[model samples]
Target: MKIAIYTLGCKVNQYETQAMEQELSRRGHEIVSFSGAADAYVVNTCSVTAVSDQKSRQMLSRARREHPGAVVAVCGCYPQTRPEDVRKLDVDLIAGTGDRMGFLDLLEQELEDRRPMEAVDRVFDRRAFEILPAGGLEGRTRAMLKVEDGCVNFCSYCIIPYARGPVRSLPPEEAAARAKELAAAGYQEMVLTGIEISSWGGDLKTGQSLIDLMELLSDAAPGLRLRLGSLEPRTIDGDFCRRAAKLPNLCPQFHLSMQSGCDETLKRMNRKYDTARYFRSVALLKEYFDRPAVTTDMIVGFPGETEEEFAQSLDFIRRCGFARMHIFPYSIRPGTPAAELAQIPAAVKESRAARAAAVADEMRKEYLEGCVGQVYPVLFEQAKGDRFSGHAPNYTEVLVPGSENLHNRVLATRITGTEGFSLLGELEETP
Candidate 1:
């Protein structure tokens, strides 16, 4: 069987797609490009916003229309949250947020029987964490280990909590074992990713937290560079910063999720923390790490967001000095609380996003300028022409002129200058 997966949404989705690809390949299936025809086409969808849903729908429709004979399977958040919406489409199999292996089983069975099947279970009823393989089918530079699944933070703008259910965490021992396996497999770096990583230990009866899990993973894979996924502001404090600072292999970049900076806007969004607490998290990271790259995501022109509120958000983000930012205009997601509220006009949302993006660009330039004259151990991933590109511990892309294929090599690189968003660097000779 030939299978091609089209994935949407977050890093977790990407990891799951890769795991599915590996499993399918292991079971005597050929992985092909989504553009070309195949025996099975898996459209892993996302419903983060209404726009994401449209894309998912379009892809599914295209898959069915182009390859009339191929099996089209739809999975992920879009169908998980709205199975009724997906049932209206021309899909053969529908699986939700959980159970990838079972989903594949159904796919194989469908191929033989030619029956339409739906395997989306009650996501909230799930208790055990579905452990998938950590690394990708092809590369060794970086791999993602999903240590946790689900989110209980029912933010007004988010549909993930309902889509992914409550917190279900991978045990510390299991996570450590996976990290060790990735290290043994010659992976240069391991990314600990999830829907909400900060809520990792909530479901487990053990009195532990994300920092504790980080310590365990660091110990298990002492040679692998461990990177973290997006974290909640409440996860960072004095103790966490201090403990995390001591982990030599842990990357110094932190992506704290901050949707809006205005307190009123945060209240409307039902965020866990206010601006004061979020800023404290930023300050703590800056205090403990040496020029740590702090990145974040922000949504502009949220429902009922006044111009003053937007101004406050811009000012607050400027103060935080984020290394980079992902800015998006507010998009109404049906079934979420915010969708029923008075919506902002599309023009207003787009204009506010542009304003926020300008500020973010300035901050990014400032961060890149600060990187000049610093030395960092960069993990090279890819090469183009005479330059090899890699990322520093702070997650900053560093490009150096080199003839050698530095793929998967961590070399000492000294920043010489800034080239747009990336830093231009020269490789240091090892003695």
Candidate 2:
């Protein structure tokens, strides 16, 4: 069977799509492109926000339009959460966030029977992490080993907890094995990705934590660089900071999730942490890692979020001095609690988003300027012209003008200056 996958949203979704691709290949199936004719087209959907749902629908529709005769299989967060909406679409197979292997089987059945199949079940009944293949088979420098699944946070604005169910973790031993497999495949970097990585060991029950798993994986792949996915602010503590910083190969870039910076807004959103706590996490990252890239996300114009609250959020984020930021204007999702709360005006949301973006841009520029004259072991992934570009240990994009194509090679590059948002420099001889 020839399969083509179209994936949207988080790194976890991308990881899942790759895992499915691996499974198909193992069963003697060919992976093709969605734009080309194929036996089946898999739409790995996302439902993080309202926009994500729309994009998922658009992609599903496009797949059907492109290959009307091909089997259209839809899975992931969107179909998992809104199966009725997906049922209205021209799809042959429907499965939810869980059971990738089962979803593949259903797709195979549909291929043979020439009939539609829906294998989705209640997401909350899900238990145990469905471990799948790690590393990229498509020749990528970085591969994500999803160590965690599901979210229990139940933040008022989030529907993911309901869509994904309770927390499930991959055992430390298994995670280590997966990391070693990825490293053996010549991958230079591995991202510890998941739905909510900070909550990794919450469901494990054993006397282990995310730090313990990190220690094991780092030990397993001593030569491979390790990067982390988005983490909850409450996850960062003195112990986590000290232990994680000790790993030499672990990248110092930390993306602490900060939906809203104001304490009042956080309370309304039912977030687990406050602005003070969030700032402490930021301070800890700054203290432990030598100039680590501390990035964050912010939602503007949340339901009932006053102008004063938005200002407070902006002020708080500016004080944190994030290296980069994702600024989003809050949008109402039908099933979320925030959707039923007092709504903010769309124009107001747009205005606040723009203001937050400006502040974020300044912080980004300041952080990049700080990188000037610093030498970093940059894993150059690709090149355009004579410049080989890659990310620094802190996730700073560094472009070095070199004659050689430094693909997959970690080169010592000194940051000469900034070129727009990226650092421009030349390759330096090894000391």
Candidate 2 minimal-lDDT segment of 10 residues: 422-431
Task: Give one digit per residue, the lDDT tens place, for model 1 in 1-431.
Answer: 98999999899999999999999999999999999979999999898988999999999999999999999999899999989999999999998888999999999998999899998889889899998988886765999999899998899999999899989999999999999989999998999999999999989989999999999999999999999999999999999999999999999999999999999999999999999999999999999999999999999999999999999999999999999999999888899899999999999999999999999999999999999999999999998678999999999999999678888999999999998899999989651
How do all models score by TM-score?
A: 0.99, 0.98
The TM-score leader among the candidates is 1
Model 2 lDDT per residue over 50-103, tens place: 899999999999988988988998999998889999999999988999989888
lDDT of 1: 0.94
**Local distance difference test scores for all models:** 0.94, 0.90
Error of 1 at 343 (Å): 1.2
Give the C-alpha miss distance for residue 109 in model 2, angstroms: 1.7
TM-score of model 1 (CA atoms): 0.99
